[model samples]
Target: MLKSALVFRNAFKILKTKYLPYTKELQKVGGALDDEDWDKIASFLPFRQIFYDSTLSFFGSRYVTGNTFVEEIYDIGYRINRSIDDLNDGVKSMARQMKMKFDKY
Candidate 1:
């Protein structure tokens, strides 16, 4: 009852903000987005080219033809995805350890 209403309210708020599914605006002057900053941050995205404002909008769900999305929750999603590199590194280290053991045998 009350709990469900509260959950719904929170969900709506998130949809309105970070996880809006798509953004249709570009970086504005002295705003949250800019060329230099986009270069620094957007690289983490899978897109080889980055676009801003309305230049890349209206494509909806399949914008980049397999363009996956991150929840831009102030970088939480980014942080999680980035851990993949670290995980790969860990696996590589373990494989090296196993190879060493096998060589000893």
Candidate 2:
């Protein structure tokens, strides 16, 4: 419960810092959204949705199973999803590379 709360808090911070600024600035300009503007906003949605989904899954699994192992597995799945996401965003981190290598084995 407490862990999920922390995750939600951090997610909100990321949304505010990384996403809200752009939207707010656009609104302030009173301009219609061009395709490029829409594309920029759409690009962030998948990453944000992943965070929300992982948080929900973490808490949901805990309540349903009450098993630490299950929770850990869920966490691992989320980490892998996040790594793939980062790779899609052009971030070739060590973890993402390792995941890709392991997938080929």
Candidate 2, after superposition: displacement of residue 95 in Å? 14
- Candidate 2 displacement at residue 104 in angstroms: 29
Tens digits of per-residue lDDT for model 2 on 1-105? 434434465454455467866658767778435545444444445545544765677667546555754665556556655656552343335447656754565
In candidate 2, stretches whose alpha carbon ends up further than 4 angstroms from where it belongs are 1-30, 61-105
Q: Could you give candidate 1's per-residue lDDT for residues 1-105 as a string of tens digits?
A: 333434365454454367434223322333333334434333333321222322344244455432233322223333433434443454345445544553465
Q: Pairing residues by index, what is the TM-score of model 2?
A: 0.33
TM-score of model 1 vs. true structure: 0.19
